[model samples]
Structure formats: C-alpha cells, structure tokens
Target: MILPYPFPLDIQSILNNKNIFRRPPTRFGKMHHTITHPFHTPDQLPMTNQRINHEPVFLLASAPWRESSLWVEVFSRRYGRVALLARSARKRQSELRGVLVPFVPVSASWYGSQELKTLHRAEWIGGWPQPQGRALFSGLYINELMLKLTTREDPIPELYDALEAVMRAVCGENSHTAALRRFEWTLLNRLGFAPDLFHDGNDEAIRAEETYWLTPENAVVPIEEAERFNPRNHGVAVGGNILIQLREGDFTHPESLGQSLKITRLLIDNLLPEGIKSRQVLQQLQQFSFGV
Candidate 1:
C-alpha cells in the first residue's frame, strides 16, 4: 500500500494495527476517501436540546445545504459533536453567516425533536483571538480529529475542556507545540489508548536525571533498562526531565516541545492509517515557509 507523505517514518505499525502502543484508529485511509465529512445527528432525542437553553459550541465544520443554508458540525460540552441544519445561513443578511465559524465559541439555539436539529440562532460568545497562520492549521487538524472520533450528541466533557484549552493556546501563539501534544494525548487517553506519561515500562515513576526511550509499544523505558524490548521498537529517545515537563504541559523548555512532537507524531500516525488532509496542508505550509 502506498503511504501518505505526511511523515516519512516507518508507518508499518499503522498498516498492521499491531503495535497497540499509543495507538489510534488505523482506518484513516477510510477516513480520507470514504468519510470525508462524516456528519450525523444524535441517535436519541434526549441527547438533543432537551434542557439546555443555549449550548456553548465550536463550529467543527460547515457544508452547503439547500444552496442558501449550511449543514454544520458543532462540538459542545454535553452534546459531543452534532449536526445542525442552518436555514439561510448563507444569505447576505443571515446572522449565522458571521456567527458560525470554527474556533469561535458560540451560544447556539436550535430546535428539533428528531435526529438533526434546525439551527435557529447563534450568538457570538467570543472572548479570545482567532487562530491564524500555523495556528489555523493546528485548529483544522484538531477539528478533523473531532469530526473523525466523536459521536453525535455524546457527552465529551473532558475532550470539550481540552478543545477550549487548545483554542486559547493556539491563539495565544505561545507554547502551541506542547498544547497540541497535550490535546493529542488527552484524546488518546479518553479513548483508553494512551500510556501513562509519568511512569515507565517497569511501572516506576520517571525521574528527572534519567534518559528514556519511548518504544512503539508505548513503553517509556529507562535508557539502561531498555534491553527487554526489541531494539528496533525502542523509538524516540527523550530526557526524563522533558517527559516531566510534558506531563505537566509546560513548554518553557524548547527541547520539550520537539520531543513532544516526535512522540505525538508517532502516536497519531498509529491512529490514522490512510492520511490526514490537514497534515498535507500543514506540510505544504511548512514547505512554502522555507521556500522549498
């Protein structure tokens, strides 16, 4: 199978789905070709706009609907991710045209007793700067992840919190690397796939002075105690101090950010086997920035 060019590492683990270490879904090739925009409504009505007056939401995506409206995807605290059909949202005078944008928090008012909600009104609840440049790419990547992993109207309270934190971090344009990595780890942990960041292969607490290797099996092994695993599987090497910083979401140390990328890249590749559109866009931006 031809691999996606987003990363050049040995991504055989993604194809085989055997590593089980820091694993993500291995069907992104499927996510790419088939489920380009996977939109769905809640299976049950109780999960819809039952008691919530105006739910805080982030517009994950939007597609043309009926030539004058939009089929929007939104991520909310109790509603997980859901689809809303906004009538006349594309009209020149529509309030939603300016309100339903990704990265901006909105208070959405929608009503329906069925699976899909008909969005009536959306008000800006913004108090943060919008993500721009590289931050925009990061936001797109994150929105794609949410579109892929989250179910309609399912409560993702923790992931919702992480999303808020990421938006603020990226717009802040400081420590974005660590912020992105932390979001990736949080997603994996919520899915019960990520390993413990504070402990190692022997279940011992990671120390600041030690050097460790992150194995493909998601094991954090002390440099001196890494012989049990296959040498080839002993992946990126990182300092225990950096791991500690990563654990605490501290990006003060530049090395910690680089190390975080190496680790998260491996884990994400493990998750999506086919390819990610946002990754391609990001690579293009990087190449353009360097005039390559």
Candidate 2:
C-alpha cells in the first residue's frame, strides 16, 4: 500500500481543491462520464506552436470537480502527464458525460500554461471494454504509473502504445499481470530510468549464473555493489533467465513474469516521489480479499 516515492505534483492538494469542480445532480447523486478532445483545431485560441500542436492524449483518471465539471489527469501520447479542468460535462444531455469514463479511449483538447491546462472538448474512440474489479484495479495501477513517471508536456508515444495494449489485455478474459508488467517495464524504459536487463553498457554479455542488480544509471553490477548504490533498497539481484526473457520481451514465462513483477515494482516504488492512493487500495485488497 506504500508508495515507492513522492510525486512532484501535489495530487493530494489537487484532490483537496475539488471544491472548484461542479458535479451534476443525479438520481443517485452521482453520474459517470468520459470525454475526449483533440489536440488542435482552427477554433482554438492563439498560442505558441509548442502548446498548439500537442499530440492526442488519453484521460486515464478523473475525479468529480465540483457540481458540473471534472478535475482530470490525463496521459498524453506527446504531452506526457497533463492536468486539465473539464467543465460542464455532467449535464443530463451532454455527450461528454458518457465519454469521460476511465479505461475508454478518448482524444482530449486542452490549452493553458506550461503547468495545468484547460480541457476544451473530448470525443470517444469506442473500441475497448470497461474494466471491472481486479481489472479496474489494474487500470488504476497503469494510471498511477503514468502519473508518477511522466512530466507535463513531455512526449512518450511508446508508453502510450503500451498503455493501450494493457487496456486491451485487461478487458479480455485472460489475467493481465504479464501485460501490466511489460507496460510497466516499457514505461520505465521510456522515462530513461530503467536498467539494462541483458548486456552491460560496454555490450559485454551478462553471465547466466551470476545475480545482478539494477541501478538508476542503467548499470548492472554484482549483488554486493548493489547495496552501495541502491538508496531505496528496491533493487534485486535477478536471475539471468529472467534477463534473457526480458531481453526478448517474453512475458509468457512464469519465472520471467515473476522476476519482472519483483524488479518493476522495486524500480517504480523507488522512483515514485509522491503517494499513490490506488496502489494502496490494491495492496490492501490483495492481502485481505480471497473472493477476488
């Protein structure tokens, strides 16, 4: 349930500022919605090329803003993690209301300062199924990872593809543990933080019998040296079999998957700077719930 690290942006602060958003009145006093808007349009306000031509994005997590809007955090393919204020999507007849739901694909439109942006519109790309229970938890895990690693306005197209892939894997009948692991690993790599799994920086082959640890600098060293460099105690001396599997992007191997889980969780935990609410909920549920 514990976070690997602290987040740069104050998610708690943003959550506390939910008074600024407006949630629409519903029969049950709650309404669910998802919305997507494109990155550019002729109608958009004049702005620099940097802000005007952002790539299409996905809004992965959102909370009720106030009475009629949403405070959303999105994973943009070209813009990395973006915080936006989606206004008035909760009206009874609003198309955006139904389109703003999480785990669904949507292209978002936004403009603002280099920090937070204003969400102008959204359009759904209806091809994926909604996640439930454990799948929902897994989706949240992906969202959390994106928020933790990506910076605002930074592009990460590869992570976006990996994310879409995970969403597909989660919606299917199969358990998405392996898919999630690969996405996590890919995120770390795209962020320029993941350690090399196979060869050394000099391109020397890794010894199959030796155990090695991953450091932030992408260095693979003997287990003894790991303790000296691993400030967070999250590094592991993984088996070479797992390394080979990772090199091949093979998630089907049970041993490889297990190692991927261990190593990725460590790296993410160590690298994340802020608290993750969903991750904590997931851990508690996993520990206590058997029916799940």
Q: For this target, which candidate reaches the highest TM-score against the unseen true structure?
A: 1
Q: Against the correct fold, how does model 2 do in TM-score?
A: 0.74
Q: Clashes in model 1: which pairs?
A: 24-271, 25-271, 29-274
Give the TM-score (vs. native) of candidate 1. 0.75
Task: Tell me the tens digit of each residue's lDDT in model 2 across 71-158.
Answer: 6777777666676777776666655776676665677777775355677777776757777777877777777667545655566678
Clashes of 1: 3
What lDDT score goes with residue 141 in model 1? Answer: 84
Over the stretch 86-130, how does candidate 1's per-residue lDDT look in tens digits?
A: 888878887766677777688987777666788887888865877
- In terms of lDDT, the best-performing candidate is 1
lDDT score, residue 18, model 2? 30
The global C-alpha lDDT for each of the candidates, from Candidate 1 onward, is 0.69, 0.63
Candidate 2: 10-residue stretch with minimal lDDT = 26-35
Local lDDT at 215 for model 2: 50
